[model samples]
Target chain A: MARFKFLVAALAAASLWAPGASATVLDNVKQRGVLNCGTDNTAPGFGYLNTKTGKIEGLDADFCRAMAAAVLGDASKVNFVIVTDKSRFNALQTGQADVVFAHTTVKPVRESAIGIDFLPINFYDGTGMMVKSASGVKSVAELDGATVCTTQGSGTEATLAAFVRARGFKTTKVLTFENLEKLFGALQSDRCNAMSTDKSALAAWRGNSGKPDDYTILPETLNKSPFAGFVIANDSRWRNLLRWATFALFQAEEWDINSANLADRMKDESAFVQKFLGAKDGFGKDFGVADDFVASMIKSVGNYGEIYDRNLGPKTPYFIDRAGTPNAMWTKGGAEYSPPWN
Target chain B: MTTLALRWVHRNLFAKPFDAALSLVIIPMLAWAVYAFAHWALVEAHWQVVGGSFKVLMTGIYPADQLWRAWFSVATLCAMFGAGLGLSVRPGRAASTVVALGVALTGVMVAVAIDVHSGMLAAGSAALGVAAWCGVHHLAADQRIVLSGLLAGVVAIFVVLSPPGFEVWGGLLLSVVLTIAVSILTLPFGILLALGRQSRITSLRVISTAYIETMRSVPLILVVYWIWIIVPLLAPDTSVPGLLRGMAGFALFFAAYVAEYVRSGLQAVPKGQIEAARSLAMSSWTLNVDIVLPQALRVVVPSLVGQILDIFNGATLVFIIGLTDFLRAGQMILADPQNSGRTYEIYVFLFAVYLAIGGAITYASRRLEAHLARGSR
Candidate 1:
């Protein structure tokens, strides 16, 4: 029995893992003519598949599209793989997808040990709480005996527990659920006094609700979180290329360059916009892409501003204003500052 | 002649006033179901989009070049079922109605499915009807055992032939393959554990008990995760695929339940029968092979059928491991942005498939139980 099992195992291993799954993922994707970029299946501010449009629309979806545009030249030339928190890393490891834009926070445990590299942070967010105005729960400290609902298996659960404990608030209780939608429902149903998750998620959820005024998301960040994107580790070539490609959006936005009026702006010969769009800059060669790589990315998906507006903009149900968030341009006091284009 | 037909109805339906009242209520419910299903299936179903995405619905993201493997695999299973029917009594009118209903449903669906190019679908179903009629017309006793064995083997061979790959596997095909794989791989181990639990030796009993208890106590997800996580940690020689891990988890978890059922069958075998074998100077192995196992298996046929049903339903647990089973594929269709509002349509389609499968399993098990119960007298 053991020998037969061994024979089967050997055959299966030889069939699936040749050299490594990671090495072939990129070429396989290129040959397939669609970048199978991974993204969150249901994160509100990140990757959420819109039922109305039949397309995944969110900030994370934009990042995946941008990556596809950088690699394949067409932003729409991508297939989206829905990755959840538990299987997200495994999906990348097993060659199910080329990269993940699944709102995965960078942790030391994930970066080196789990075999995936984090791209630059797309959304600098932190945990926050939302409460009904009628609940009289003005601040985190004010809710001593109140039950707070949070999504299960997230850092929010632990943080809520620790905060309640350390503050010597004995009457406070924490509740956890598998999904934010259920957690929010719990809050709305008066089963819990407050709902807690990432601040951006809270913003999106509250805004997406038809009765947005019924709830309010507090500005207090319960915990610091940076939602970084990732690709399989051990491929520095792809890593460097993806990182610079993302930063190109930040640089474009900082220089007031967008999809609309890019040509008109480019003819100014400011050298920065020209160099950034790869008119004569030597950066694209360093990344093994065309000289106009960033130009292709911006042209296809538009600058980061345009992508943001289309997905999570104030005009949408989420109605998010990007002007004050850390996702704003560096010159405007947000953290999306890019190193100067040569 | 009209009065005679009325008399027959009165005898069957109005024999009891209570039964007549119940039928009155049930008839409307039945009519409502028929009306609703027929109208939606014909008038409301968006067949144009569905027809266009036929290849996607069937093959998922599986590469077109490798789809031959899936087709061949499916055909092998179909042939096995066809051969299995050769061993049994011809289906009665009730059984034939189910078969006819399935064929008719498929016919209506295919007709609606293709807008401009529905070529051989209705004809293909008609051909299947003819083939099934032929099979039911000719079946034998000795052929039954061979048919069942081949059915099992066909499942095993098809799963193995999936080319050490997952791309050719998707949709309902994935569900059927995983269920069969679990049942086949787990059967022998289940037998061993059952025998070991019934063994006179203390060590074997203790080991078997521990295994059965541990497996039955844990959730299916935990076992699946163990296969994914622990195999890489402990086994230097094996790198388990996600689908294999899923199947192994299902088998290990379900084998315990199957063993208990088998053990009950073993206990049902009379002690006198074993003593009689021993008196004839038969070894334990010979006695078990000749006398004990056959009777025990016969006694447990219904229970084994029940276990198979459980295994079929349990196949859905593979979705967490990222293998697209039927339910997961249904969910994937909903992932299309355009199909978002069509949740009711998609879910109704899934409900129909699951209902058909579940009904068949339950009906088979009940029939087996009725047959087994007769032996007690």
Candidate 2:
């Protein structure tokens, strides 16, 4: 009897090695009835868990839901898998996630070496500096002789060094710490006159500070760091599905459609709006998804502006202004322009 | 009474002039630090963030409607724990009183801090605790029955929890489940490796030694990462759940350490006993099974308990593979910019919880060691 039990256990363990391969990610996701969307659980505004709601609610999280809505026709069919900055690409490559919307910056080396295709830039961020309001500094230009602190081994360190050199600030000093907590502490204790990092992170840190009003983020950005979703490289079917799903958010904003009025807009006489909503001659069928994918996605998550307003807009705690930035709509003279739907 | 207290204080704190001076300086600093911490924790800290986010901290993003599954899992665990305690060591009066006091304090704090709905769950847990105590005190069940019941409870927890799949497992629930699964799965493998290490066969000894040495030399995170990345590639058709892969990696890595511990226990067993059994015409299998294995396992129980605690603490590393455990859940809560200022309160709560759990395990292992020693003597 013991020998038989051992045999059974050995077979059971061996069965885990059996090949159960499936088709592409799209088909697997559809068959499984859920989209595994990778995101950062710790990134405020981009992706963070809303403790009160027992749900992940942020711009990147909303985009995950949007992708789920586009593919599965139910935005609630998304299971968020948290990915850290270092692990996001590996997650996609290993097929651990269907799509990653973890505020990854689009870089050439990432695409070429990491072998992952980036979607269109959804949130444009840049290296920026912050200073104490009482210090009487208004912009990066005025910090000529200031000492700046940033986290070590981050792109911000190199960016700060380049910014200081390019601006020809003779006495400006750059100090690096092992992590954000120490850098923030050094800045708070007057060890550094300024702190530099990604603008979004700076805003989040400022908002979390004891007195948010004591700090000011400079308007001048050092360099562009456009954030986007990414997927395993060379799978155009899966890649295009995610890319167009992101583009639909931008298009929905241009078409003046949002979650609140999606139902009414679905009945609009305009052929283009109807097509975009997948009501008439929709693109979902061509993309191997449901015809009403866009409409369902809109009803579930909302347009780009609504997602922004809900997560990072003035009403939210982060309160990052979108005006005069690439994040704003192109019609409003920003860089967020989508290709013509036709 | 005042004079007695003064004498006690003098002996403990100010017996010598140097001691008195050191006490004068350190006492005030310690008092001030304690006072400041208490003021911050009880009077000044915004505990509402913790209260509001308590559910997420306990079970991150677990569907709210299916929360009863988690509660049932907890109740089952309590019953299993009670049965194990009953089988191992009957609670003395002092131990019972301490447990009762701890439960009472926890219940009162839960009632004060949480809303009515959550308070009802706490009340239910308290009721289960009472029931567990009663069952243990009165049942007088057989050891095998209690062990089977505990095994059943583990199965029931998996059945109740796995319907949501491994992806939904998060927070403390994920941590506890992972630790339990890895510890249980590693035991048999560990024993096999230990036997192989001692085998006279060259091939078996060499392979076992190589595996144990290789696993022990690398960091655990690297093992988890390698398994997570390489396993899928090796069997692309087999879509193993990330949690299971992680557990497998953890078990495979820790089994080496467990094997070494068991090997020490094996060595500690008397050579005469094995020779006597062989002289009595007992086969190697019977000798090892009936005599050597039981005595070896008994000798290593305390170390095994310590390893269990280590695995529980090590479950925090799962977050590297994107599975949210207890520590990551706290980080998720702090990630909310709205609750950023409550970092101290949240971290304190996490620290207290880890300390409580780890301390309890250490205490239980010490008790078990004492009990085993008594039996041997």
Candidate 3:
């Protein structure tokens, strides 16, 4: 029995380590006719599985479809690879996924050391605190001398301690747990007076709680948390294609070209609008993708506002307000700016 | 009857003043706890959530059209399990009665939980299971043939399920697959490592010692993550599926601990057995294979069963590498904002399932241990 076992083990190990040829991610994706876009399958507003339709639907999911539409002229050509927070970077690095949109925050160490490049910021989130509404705490100032809970080793802990100190709360104690579930449990059990994390995450937790209206997110922002999609380093062709595809979503919103009215706008005589929609002398040829790539994308997954309204708008379950936030359009006095299409 | 009951109560609970006080306090508390749990589970809980998410919880994100594949896999497993159990051990009347009651209760629960189509499929599978059990009982003399047939069933399941790619495997299906694959692969690797550790050759001993120590030192997560990352770098063209990589890492890591257990078993085997074989002019291979291993493995059957249980529980960790196991599937169900505030209900359902499966495995191991002990005597 022992000798036979040894033979089997050796054979299995040998088969796993066999040598094979490699190819560039761009070539592989093009040949496969599918863009493997990794996204979070558990996040509520950003990316989530819709139980009714049995399809992934959210802001991040829309971006993946748009990328596929831009590159392959069919939004359905995308394979939505589910990635968690820990595996997102590794998935991109190994060419298992072509692009990752797992709500990754832009950090200098990730770009310099991990060998990944971030596109323009798609969503700007910030750290905030939430307290039970019954406590009559409307802002961080009211939480002096109270225990606040966040995940251990997360940047939120340090940011929370700094905020408490700056406010001159001598008795404020910051408690840390290993994960969000425990932190929420601590707050629920009255072990902590408040919980601090990214506002988007707080919203999701609050939405999932028994009484969403019972909790209130404090007004003051503790820290910045701008998120963006990323791809592997040193692949300029693939990188540019993903970057421009993201930019096209915002540009479409700026040009008033949405999914519902895209065909009508295509008939406009303005040279700039015509070029923007890839009617004539389009810039898609310069980028090495399809000439009418943006048009295909808009037709499949609407403009940025439509995507937001479908996933995080007031009508949706998440109900995230984008009216006065940086996610709003530039014309509406928010920070969503688009570069020149010409 | 009243006099007898009073005597029993007086002896067990109220023999003295202190005993009476303790019984008065503890009995009511236990009764209240049971009552509260029954209320929450039976009446207050929203079981509709469990009913609605049943498919996703069974096979996450698998194509709806391909659901028949999952049912087929389940049917195959049922047949194999029935046949194996029928051939392995004979139970007395009391044990057989208990098993029958458990099966009847499970059948009633299934009929209540699933739709008509699924109930029909389940009934058909149960018929197949009954036929397998009867057939195996008649052919119990050819144990080798039965074992080979069971092994072929496992391979057939893999062939039917592997075509959809590892990414689509999620929920309970992923957990069962990972546990089975790791359990099958670990035994052979473990035996080799144990022999290497016990070898007379200096180089083999040192290398095996080093491998086992290194694997035992690091966390399972790091080993799994390293394999997930390094495999692609080593063979870029042939992308190994993440699920397979995770299974390989688990098998490798677990084999080390299994090697230690098997080594203890090897040590337990009397040195007289080997000396007797040598006196009979038996070769080392035949002596070890035909004599030492059978005894050693028999002594360690209980430990191997425990290791398999550990593998099943550890399957939940695959979510870190983006593969959803049973636990992660529950979280995914909660990820839908509409299912908010149903955390307790979802968690209660998951707990019930894990408890049921774990309890069943433990019961079988206990029975096996008893049977083996009887045979040795």
Candidate 4:
């Protein structure tokens, strides 16, 4: 019995054996009837749950739902499983979720050591800090001798602690909460003077607090971990479909198309827009989907810019300015670029 | 009066300076725990946080409307509990006090878990019926208490379960319902498997032993995962929901463990007892039931209680296959931004809950072991 249990644990611990010889996650998901998509149901503007609708909303959730719509053709066809920072990889490798869009940052160890594969960067969020106006703490440097609250096992906590220590900021107390909500709550409740997290999340905390004016995200880009979607590695076919589906959302935005306007935009003189929308040619069929798959995804959700701004961009609650950040489109001199749909 | 109280403590805790020194260290830790619990339970913790979201505590992602099926289950269990104690085991004064403490704890839970929906009332009434029947049965044997109690329990569960298919069952209640239902469900199977293990027939022994060993060898999660994945594969026509698969997996896993324990008890029974009953010319059925089973069960009562505790703890593993219980509920609640900063608050609650339930199971097992020992003596 113990030997059998050891075998099971060894399989779990050695999760990086690559995918099985045949089949893709797409097949498993299709057979299962519902898309087992992972998401954070707390990170505002990324993947927070709406109390009223009880639905997970934000950029990452939108991508998960849109992928579900593209594949399953129903946005509601998803079983939105929640995973925390510490448990995301285990959830995916164990097959609890078919796709994880839980603000999962791409790293080599995760791909190699942890045994999972990364999709395109779904949400670009980097580490930043927040402090009250009264503290006169404008940059990371001013946080000397300060007690900061953040979550444990997160890259942000490590970076912050290192940055403070490197700067020789003595008396810097780092308190770790299991989630940012607690860390932010402790910040608001005066339990801790400053809270740190990804820039997107810091802005999210500010917006969702119902009193956004009191919080300020420091201008320092302390870390650059881009949140990417992922799945269990080895299913290249399904990986391709999901990867292309993502870039298509970005391609749609680049073509000045959206769920509301893609139908009319398909008739434009530019052959690229037409082919991309499947108006001139069926582009999506060979990927195990309909030719109008990108059209449907754009129709169900929207283009990349629409998704971002609606959730995290400047006009949204996170109020993140996309014009100057890496999150902006290539036309705007940013990394939010995708290849031609064909 | 206080000095005398101190003197009494000194005698028990400080017979020697070393003992007194141990008491000094232990007393402060216990005192701190008491102080912390008092402040949190009475002062700091948020009861107001529980609103219409009662299902969050009861069942993680368990569809809310079907909660009645789960509530009705409580009455069925209460009825069985009362019947079992009345028919065979007599709970001592300490046992009765502990049971009252459990009731008080439930009452406290009721006060907090007060968002009772429609079917909860019927479930509540069913419990009252069993309590009344037990009272009447204890008062007078002529009242037909046993039969009435069983009927009320069954009917209540039937009424509640019929509307909401068992799929919507959830929360700690789901775990309890599953533990009780699965333990009862596994009993006959475990017994049969145990008997098969002991049988002289070659094929039956091999098959039963293989079944027991295979199940005992794997973790409960693997069996549940296999059932979750394979049930659909083998029987495409049958679509068993996640919760049912979880229950079935639990039954399979627990049946193996229960069989081993039962087999141990069977092994321990004195050969003389069996021979004496056989010498009286009693049939195998009568000897098995009247003598062997009673003695074997008494020997294994503590072990059985311990098994129930194991089943309760193992129910949490069902989450890997996506059936949420209490711990999963904590994760789900922390998903909300309002409750996001409340991980410390929520996890603390979960630890306390498991500890409390586990402690109760341990207490009951100890009490039963003592009772069985005393009865034997």
DockQ of every candidate structure: 0.13, 0.44, 0.43, 0.18
* Span of ten consecutive residues with least summed lDDT in model 4 chain B: B115-124
Residue ranges of candidate 1 with Cα displaced over 4 Å: A1-82, A89-99, A105-117, A124-226, A231-241, A252-281, A284-324, A331-335, B1-59, B63-89, B113-137, B141-164, B200-206, B232-240, B279-285, B372-377
Q: Sort every candidate by DockQ, greatest first.
A: 2, 3, 4, 1
TM-score each candidate: 0.68, 0.91, 0.90, 0.71
A1-342 in candidate 1: lDDT tens per residue? 999999877745532353254354455556677887877644665776443333567888999999888877788987776666777876666565778898778789988666678989887778888999776666677877888889999888888887788889888788899898799889889999999898877876676554666786654667778888887776777778889889899888877788887777667578777877876764777676677888888887888888888766766555455565676777777788777778
What CAPRI grade goes to candidate 1?
incorrect
Arranged by lDDT with the best first, the candidates are: 2, 3, 4, 1
Tens digits of lDDT, candidate 4, A1-342: 999999877655545432342267787777776887887755666776454354668888999888887787777788776666755775576566788897777888988877777988866678878887677777778777889888989888889878887889889899999887678879988788789888876885676565666777776667787889998887887888889889998888887899788778868788777777777576777878677777878887899988887776656557766765678898997788897655
**lDDT (0 to 1) per candidate:** 0.71, 0.84, 0.83, 0.73
Checking candidate 2 for backbone clashes, the offending pairs are: A20-B237, A20-B238, A21-B237
Error of 4 at B349 (Å): 4.9
Docking level of model 3: acceptable
lDDT of 3 by residue, A103-183 (tens): 889999989877788977888788988888888897788888999999999989889888987899999898999999998
Candidate scoring better on TM-score of 2 and 3: 2
Best by TM-score: 2
Q: Residue B209 in model 3: shift from native, Å? A: 2.7
Worst 10 residues of 1 chain A by lDDT: A13-22
Off by over 4 Å in 3: A1-24, A131-154, A161-195, A210-220, B1-26, B91-104
